[model samples]
Target chain A: MCLKSVEGIVLVVGDNVDTDAIVPGRYLTLTDTRELGKHALEGLDPSIPGKLKERNLIVAGRNFGCGSSREHAVLALLGAGVKAVVAESFARIFYRNAINRGLLVVEAPGVSQKVSDGDRLVIDLESGVVVLASGETLPFKPIAREVLEIIEAGGLIERLRKELQYGRG
Target chain B: MVNVAMDSLTAKILARASGRDRVEVGETVVATVDKVMIHDVTGPITLDLIDNLNARIPKPESLYIFLDHYSPSPSIPASGIHRRFRIFARTNGVINFFDVGEGVCHQVMVEGIVKPGEVVVGADSHTTTYGALAAFSTGIGSSEAAYAILTGRLWFKVPEPLYVRLDGALPSYASGKDIILSVLGILGQEGANYKALEFAGPGLRTLSMSDRLTVANMSVECGAKNAIFPLDEVTLDYVREFNTPIDLSSLSYLRTAKVESPHLTLDLSTLEPMVAKPHSPANVAPVPSVEGVSIDAAFIGSCTNGRYEDLLAAARILKGRRVSKDVRLIVTPASKRVLMRALQDGLIKMLLDAGAVVTPPSCGACFGGHLGVVGDDEVIISSSNRNFVGRMGSPKAKIYLASPVTVAASALEGCVTDPRRYLG
Candidate 1:
């Protein structure tokens, strides 16, 4: 989790990178999220998942994860050991699903255009800052404090589990 | 009058569900759910997570499960999904299980369980279809659904309302599918991103409840969180199926819950039957412009336009005519009730007699799961909600989205021809 600031290599892609491109629909029936990760980006670039061995941050164009709202895209990215996804904009349902599933995503307008493929950048979720390798810093409107708390707890399910247990106690 | 109704239905519905006097956009509140639906595609994932939590669904009445994605089980893995859904429902005492071939989840939800002004959530994105009947329904992923299943409460951020005003009457051959397709054209791919689409105006009065459902079903194509129409006699009559002899005309909630917006008005009188080309729903074109695009198959079924009326429209064109020799036309109803209704009205016989194979109610053809998947380089004209690359088959296969009328006409011609040519 990128709860605090960390640096990693960035993978750059273009706009409207949809769910089909992330993980093809045929592999969706796999119930386990970890298994879903193996086929990540099989449609667009079959080698992207395996090639993600070193890259932890994905910077892409607008409406990343657009199209049918399946959580498999998020699960696949997580399974591929992706630390975060940054794009100019994201599909509505995918954004919510990413939040609930504890997938770190940053919506930074110029983020994708600024970084080259394999550019190592330092990102801090708490500060909403991305420090580029060129020494230029970009700022983003930070996610709400509550949303950060939920993500820090490893998503809504884990947060609710704690809340429910506390209520029972 | 309609403008005030459009003020914000999301707030009213969420406030009531959360036991708050009012809620504003961006405030996330956990609200009580009227229904929690999971389909064959997303159900197994949700059920598996629930088992880990060691929780049974809190209220069986509010839990709905369906197996419409792969009806009759196309393969062993698909059958495995059905078994998992069945086991979960049986163990949790879920009373709203609709086994394979019953119906698509959206159609079954509206016909059997959804009521006006309730908060409904589902594992599937198209679950936003319930908003047509005045429910605050939205799609949540399987993870959120698992949380809602255990607690009967789901978190919602009240989305801002974007009014899609409709005026004038739909021309001949134009159905609700065209109306929504036109909206998608005007709004583009992400035009309504994160907003709730509120439909209003005199054009709605001339539209049927089925039309409203079709419009609501595809609102997600424009990135809408929910698509809703105001409550009127159309809604009252639809609700009569679940609760009869109930007078809702004087209900204050009806006035507040109905969405209203006058900002973006569309005149249906001038609108043309539309089609979305390959890659995206927003890649729209008029029927005439895209006509004669040769196709190998035509499918008329999906949660988007698969209703009794849609089947009837297709049958009208296929009656007394044969589908082109090379083109295979597959028609699947949205629900068993709709299939039975079509049979009673002789629509099924007309389609079958036209050499159009009318299959059981399922979402197979729409999602490329089974039934009528097209081969690489082959073209298909379909009435399904999406045509994103590889949506119906090989990423190389092209799927064009149109109304049932256009699909039927295209089937008869073996190409993407306009239905107006056949109707006239």
Candidate 2:
């Protein structure tokens, strides 16, 4: 079943927030999502993880997740209860990693400018629009259908399992 | 009316992989992958996913596994993971498993495995390095890698190619590292986001294969999906040396394909040594401008710039010279092959004589994983790519990215010095 929507309070961050900032390299050995969550954004600001407890949405500027192909960054966010990341843009690998891991990453330009920390956001995966607390709606480019299928299946591993069982993957 | 379809090498490669005559930009295609790679860091995750999904790889020979990162088991946990990898490889009958000290996956792949016009995916972003060999390569996440390994295929959105035309040979003071850093400076941190950087023009004749590899290795640093050089004598010469058999007729597309227009035309002769200042690969500047900035450490190695050519360049600068008393110099070869070649060439001896600590071939301290991790408030000048915050250790520590020659010069001066001063 496809996820229709996600609504949550957001934590805002600035531009060029890299993967090293999302999950430091030291804790990469900890692959468990929950364990990785404890250190989300540790390099950027230690207090960010504390804020994530209350806000499960992230509003960010351009080039979020800009370094390394470590899936730990996406796992860290998932572990921290981050339901979706609405950024102006994302580094390509991080964008792919997020989708492959079933993380909702919408690239809605200017979404970062209108949204502030703690503001509530409603992301409708179907319409590819983000509904903000101020009632302003921002439309993001719809993700590719192939990518959506992966996300709908709750990640690549799950999707692959189903595909293999069906012998049509 | 022109009937011929003018496609960049990126499009042609993707088209071929997808079993189509041509593919459009932004179109997603389920393409067969010619090669797949995973490192110690991402390898374990892939294995775990494979186990959970109960999937068996149909063709294990296409998969390459390397124990490069946290290599030789940096800790008990790392060793345990490495042990699991060995067992998994043996049980699965995968023959291309590279043991610890073999070298980085990217280095080893290009040494003899990856071929032009092939689609390669690796769990590490530097997999873009294979593009130097005329292959279409990009990095993927662990889960994606697992899926690719099981199916021998993955989907790729054909990226728009950004043509970079080079016009002249690089000045003696500059290397491919400088060329890439300068390009990154022009194209900022995200300038080429999701775009393919295609290299061509007469200047392509000037760069050695090692130089091309260094330039392509850091494509991801500027948000490029992949960076490719055309198949020329330089690439052919290198591949021939390794005895990689290939069908030359099929590779004509690489040499003949052209983009509509060049996005950036660079005169390599005008270039000089460059550095990416503290914290960002795109935060680049000429080496002369950043000269005199003190450094606590200087390192020359990693998949980015740790080849035999890079080592020899550094050795030339360090010969008959002692490293500054205040600066600790660390040299890690990219692979065991590179290490062996360097040792035979006496580059290792020159570095050791210059008071540098030579670590075994591994992705040591490049990602701050194990050896050579910098401390708080420390400043390091490295030849490896990516100087992101805390990348080489403490978040408080700063990293300056440069070529190996610049690294050697800086180690001797205990500061960021112009490599040109010693190059001639």
Second chain TM-score, each model: 0.96, 0.98
C-alpha lDDT of residue B306 in model 2: 92
> What TM-score, over all chains together, does every model reach?
0.95, 0.98
Interface DockQ of each model:
0.66, 0.84
User: Would you list the clashing residue pairs of candidate 1?
Assistant: A22-A41, B5-B260, B6-B260
Q: What is the TM-score of chain B in candidate 2?
A: 0.98
lDDT of 1 at B72: 75
Which tens-of-lDDT digit does each residue in B1-424 have in candidate 1? 2343334766777888999877778788878987888888877777777777776566887889999989978889888888988887888788889999899999988884787788899888898898888888888888888888888887777888888778899887898999999999989888888888888777888888889999999999888888887777788788886463343643456554332435588999998889999878888999999988999999999999889999998888999999999899999999999999999999999999999988899988898888887788989999999887777878789989999999999999999898998787
DockQ-derived CAPRI band for the predicted complex in model 1? medium
* Model 2 TM-score on a 0 to 1 scale: 0.98
Clashes of each: 3, 0
Q: TM-score of candidate 1 restricted to chain B?
A: 0.96
Q: Which ten contiguous residues of candidate 2 chain B have the minimum total lDDT?
A: B1-10
The candidate maximizing DockQ is 2
CA lDDT, candidate 2, residue B197: 92
